[model samples]
Target: MKNTMAEDKIVADKTIATKVIEKLREDIINNRFETGSRITIKEISERYGVSPMPVREAFRTLEGEHLLEINPYKGATVLRIDEQFVRDVYGVLRALECLLYETALDEIDQGVIQKLRCINEQIRAIVDLPYGAAEYVDLNTKFHSTIMEHSKNQKALEMYTHYHEIISTIRKKYIPVPERIRTGIEQHEKLIEALEKKDVLLVKMAVDEHIKSALENFMTQFSQGK
Candidate 1:
């Protein structure tokens, strides 16, 4: 009976901890908490209507994900993102994404191109909506993932997925900025055009430029502390 009771308690704690993690992650990504701001277990527990244990578990998880920092004396704080961090994250993305695109190029067909076009259209449709930034970002991810799926390289795909998750929070942080959305749409169009022409070199060049431009824009935003 004691063993069963302990197991149940563990399960209950895990369930609450999972909920806390999800809510905190969303709030952090959505910029509800400012960078470098301290977050305490008591505050999160009261805010989310959970006990301190669950909030503490969630903090450990977030710290592992690079979303929060656990200080010895100050509790958990949102990590301060810098220009170098932006460059490094995006640089890894560009490297992985370019390799995926190149490997997937010849395997791409008319149907894949059509699918990408539809996703691009969906992205454009949501860009101007008041609450559409998240949806827009999701659709954009789908568009790129579609092309990358053809790579058939399990290791590359896994690496890309990890990198994607890391940068996704960054995207959520800046989702309210419209210029990035607009520029992404333009770059997508160019990439699709290159694919239609069956010009692999052109596709590579376009992707290179797109990633460089995105890095520049992201760094510009980070430097301005926006």
Candidate 2:
């Protein structure tokens, strides 16, 4: 009976900790926590109506994800975004996407192509809206994911999904400019057209150029301290 009771207690603690971690992650992704702002265990514990133990456990997990940093004197502060981090993550993401595109080229069907075109049209229509940047990010994710989903290599698909999630988190704080959005849509159109032509080289080039343009634009903003 004591062993069972102890097991239940452990499970309960884990459940609470997991909940705290997820909530905190969502909050951070939504920009509720500013870059370099401090997060306190006591504050989180109070907000979640839980003891500090679970909050601390969640903090450790967030730290591992590079979303939080724990200082002995200062407790926890949200990590500042860095150029290297953006470059590295985006670099890996681009490579994974290109690989998936190549592997899945033959597998992409007309229905999926139409779906991507539909998504692009939605993106173009929203360009004038104030909140279109976020919507574009989401639709763009779906557009790429639709193609990446056709990859027969499960491991590549998984890696692309993982990198894309991190990219999504990064994007939450960014709102692309109208020019960038317009250029991005054009690139997407080019990619779709290339795919329709069944030109392998053109498809690969379009994908590479699209990623390059995005990376350059992001780097330019990061350098300007935007």
Candidate 3:
């Protein structure tokens, strides 16, 4: 009975740790933890009402995701924004998005294009309101994710998701300004036009330009501390 109980406890601990990790991951991705903030195991354990072991395990998992940096005595701090990291990620994303557009041109249907158009329109409607930055960010993610889903390339989808996770972190720190937001909407509309026309070359160019322009704007703001 003692051995059986110990095994059950171990299993429970693992489950609890996984749950904590997932919850914390969401919080981090959602920018709940302020940029450059430290995350202590004790605080996490207290907040989640879990043991230190689970909190530590959760931290380790986040660390692996490049979302946290663990110091020997200082505990964990959210990773700082790296401009080069964003540049490299966006570069890769541009290339992959172009490839996805080409491959998905024939496979993409009117329904998917219409869905994207709706999302874009919704994004436009909210661009001038309070908290519009956050809403735009979410809508932008949904728009790109929807496109990737229709790409029908499992490997490409996986790669895109990985890059997207990192990009989400960067975006939270530097939400685009109103002008950039307007430009992004325009670019998205052009992308939809390209898709509707089934012009693979045009779609690819539009996607690349959209991403490149966004990246440039983000880097400029990041440098200027806007």
Clashes of each: 0, 0, 0
Off by over 4 Å in 3: 1-81
Find the candidate with the highest TM-score and give its number: 2
In candidate 3, position 197 carries an lDDT of 93
Distance from true location, Cα of 133 in model 3, Å: 1.2
Every model's TM-score? 0.66, 0.70, 0.68
User: What tens digits encode model 2's per-residue C-alpha lDDT throughout 1-226?
Assistant: 1122222232344588776776676677556678888878987776667799988998998887677999876679987657877788888887887788878888887887899899999999999898888888888888888887888788988877766666666665667888998999999999988877767788889998999999899788767755
Judging by TM-score, tell me the better candidate of 1 and 2. 2
Q: lDDT of model 1 at residue 179?
A: 73
Of the candidates numbered 2 and 3, which has the greater TM-score value?
2
- Give a tens-digit lDDT track for model 3, residues 48-147: 6678998899888778767799987787998754677568878988888888777777867889988999999999999999989989988988987777
TM value for model 2: 0.70
Please write out the lDDT profile of model 1 over residues 95-169, one tens digit for every residue.
887788878888889999999999988888888889777787678778898998899677988988866776776
TM-score of 3: 0.68
